[model samples]
Target: MASGKKRGKKPEVEFRNTQLADALQTQDMAAVAFALRHGPTVVPLMRPGARDDPRDTGEVWTFRDPKTGQVALLLFSDALHKPEAMPKAVGLHSPEWLRAFLEVHGDEITTVFFDIAGPHPMQASPADLIAALDA
Candidate 1:
């Protein structure tokens, strides 16, 4: 069975949430909110590497509208689902981390995009998402 294919070791922590992935596919706001509040999510990072563990936090990548001066936060159910157009680096973030991030950046971030430019794309207001997380 020793063919020349080198396999990497399995990650200590898995960063994918099936519920969130399904909710994104369905484009259900309520389900998405629930999943976001209860499950881990993948966030693009400005750094140069990908971290499979949720314990590691990095500088989150955000999109800013030049015309409106509004910022958008892009998230994914899994790091694999991140779009190629986005930053190559990614971080697996816990629900608590996500809530705190939104609470701190809520005023500046106007929009939150789930799997943007992908098979399942959904958008929500930062205020609504923050409320959902609180509830």
Candidate 2:
């Protein structure tokens, strides 16, 4: 049988947690924390910039639980930057920079808070958030 219609490939399903996406989009630290605890797995979509201008803004990160394999997505207003201790030679907002930063500072990152040019700061404990997420 001959058919005129062309078949198209099905879109790949990349897990993007709606709850986490909403939280990050609004920059709601509390919500972000909540989602981190309870939401699905996620991975960052890495897009490198040119050598001359190497700043990438509006990065999206996907968080994934190692055990459950749940996925979630988070959007950052600005590109992820290297820690102050790092030299400028390290590309800013690059995945490599972020990996280095996390390797050094991952232990220190316990909670999520909204501190970007706004009043009324919010805080959440990692333990509590983890508990909530596990529940």
The global C-alpha lDDT for each of the candidates, from Candidate 1 onward, is 0.85, 0.41
Model 2 per-residue lDDT tens digits across residues 1-135: 869888999896444445555676675756765665554433234443454754543233334558875432222222222122322222113234434434444455544332222222334443444444444
The number of the candidate with the highest TM-score is 1
In terms of lDDT, the best-performing candidate is 1
Residues 45-90, candidate 1: write the lDDT tens digits. Answer: 9973434854557789999999998899999888878878887987
**In model 2, how large is the Cα lDDT of residue 91?**
17
